[model samples]
Target: MTSKHSLRNPKDMQYAFSYFYYLIHKKVPFDLDKLWAKEIDINRDGYLNENELRTLAINVFSTPLKPTTFKEFKSDLYKTCMELRHPTPAPVIVEESSSSDSSDSSSSSSESSEDSGSTAAVPVIPATQTATATAVATATATVTATTAPKATTPAVDNNTLEVGQKELEACRIDLEVLKASNKTLMEIHKSYAKRTMYRTSIEGTDEVAFLMVDDNDNSTQTKLDGVRQRRHKFICLNDNINHDKPTAHLVIKVIHDFYESLFPFPSSFELPPGQTNHFRYIHEIIDKKQEENNKNNTFIYIFGVVGVMIVMLMWKRSKRSSNGNHHSINGIIGGVGNKSAAKQRSNKRYMIV
Candidate 1:
């Protein structure tokens, strides 16, 4: 782990280790190009750490991985760790991230930049460990774990319980955060799809329609005839999109163009239930993209607030490591799911044991 010269990219080292972690702990993407895009940080002229990385594996992997894959991860785990300077003291979490970014001063626009404002969310350690450690270790670990909460039991160390509650609460909070992020993204997608819908009582003269429409709005029942030489409706999921969901809007736009070319006039294409309506779908995709852009701005703001929690977790984990407090999950937590909150609290009480 000791080397005289710093690796050309410490973050690369971090990324490599994180990549190894995914290779070990999580799934890996299949496409070589997509995998490379996920693996390398083209930002800061080099690499990036875990949070900012979009797991290629997560994107491409659809099902459970074979058990044997873990062996490969385990094999490379030590080398990658040594390269990354394993179990290195976690960083002190920083609450505020000023764009006075010394690191990536020369990157492209927010979209292209690797500074996606995501940092690793330290996973939740069960609360029981906090109880078993000595008061001194408990106090230090609390600082690393961070957050605000009260003691639940009298027999166990009150301070330990207080801190455990905090970290666990923080974990729960972060889960909410990730959930909110995904939810917002999905919402924007939906809204974008909706906005693309173009249902207007036109005198019927927009040339983009795939079918040539001959609708007369003045009539009691206008027959919206499409243009003669329109093309087939664009099939969305059929084609391979290079980028992630960000490109969904573009795909929608392409569909719009196809619809316009195909339907020459005012005729509406029949869409199956729960599928996209040509007009509304197109409108939604456009609005949703703008929303996505706005999210990038908001992400910075939201991340600024959470930065402190992330740093604190690192700091706390480091502090715990220094004192030789060890923790890992076991069956004492009871069956995986369906445990009542009370039971979970009790099981967590024994996590360290």
Candidate 2:
């Protein structure tokens, strides 16, 4: 490929490349062949040289080229090259100066008279060239102003901003509801913690009675009058209750309702022997499951320790074997050296004898 630095003008190359790109995408509004010939073939040679084509390929279309697309590009380029073999003639531009000649002559005469009276000399300029230069400068300035890129700030939509604010407000409302729910749950827990249960004898009767009291305040007390009355105590207390402002009575009622739902009161004031045994059975089952889990965990710990010990024993055995082999090799080498020295001394004594 030709180097980008070798190209005479990068702007012309970019423009020509844009035309080529438009042609490839089938977006050219004008004749592709005519545009390519006019813009790319700067010397009117009617042909794009290797250097020009390489510049277009490297600078303009510098992407990974697919084989099929590249083949299509080469085919279109070949057809355009064959069709535009002959150079077209340049258009002639004629400037008419006859209408302004009289005005120019009068102005020149006045300027000449002024120059003759003055001491300094001024250079004469052609009116026609000055007018042409002014028009060219104005056209260049207009084209530059139009083509130059403008710096723009991205616009933010008010509708999207409003939607975001609405979503944020909804999230805040949800957070408040969650906080209120948490506070209610905490109040329920505190009410349960302050409850007290005990058995007491009525003043004149031999019968014992159970009383459920709320220790949160001294105003509220609940008494189980008799065995028949125990069943409906929770129900009667929960009826006609207001929970919005949980006073001492309301708190006691809520706690009693929560406890009775889990464990209903027995028919007698004293708990039945069967019910007591059932509770003991449940506790024993939980303790047994917990003991089994602890045993399994202990077995796993011992097995891991044994595995580590076995590995360490194997490593020590291998190290001892290697050390024994190295010592044997050193001893064999030392014995061979001593044997050779003894043989050399015996030969030397025999030669002296």
lDDT of 1 by residue, 1-353 (tens): 22344434343445445554544444222332332343433343233233222231122222363434322222232223222332234347533223223223222333343354455443433345333333444455566467422333212221212222333233322212322344333432343333222333323334333222212222211211222333223221223334355545655555455457555465455555478644446778788888999999999989987998899999999998866633333444444554677687888889967
Query: Any runs in candidate 2 off by more than 4 Å, and if so which?
Result: 1-283
Assess every candidate by TM-score.
0.14, 0.21
Q: Which model scores highest in lDDT?
A: 2
Residue 196, candidate 1: how far off, in angstroms? Answer: 19
Task: Report clash pairs, candidate 2.
Answer: none
What is residue 323's positional error in candidate 2, in angstroms?
Answer: 1.2
Error of 1 at 163 (Å): 30
Tens-digit per-residue lDDT, 1-353, candidate 2: 12354444544455545655554454223333453455534555543444444443432334574545444333344333222332233334333343245446656765886778766565556768667755665665566566544444222222212222333233222212212334323432343333233332224333433444444333333332233354432322313234454574656564566556646865655666555434446688799889999999999999999999999999999999999999999999999999999999999999999
Alpha-carbon local distance difference test for all models:
0.39, 0.49
| lDDT, residue 314, model 2 | 100
TM-score of 2: 0.21
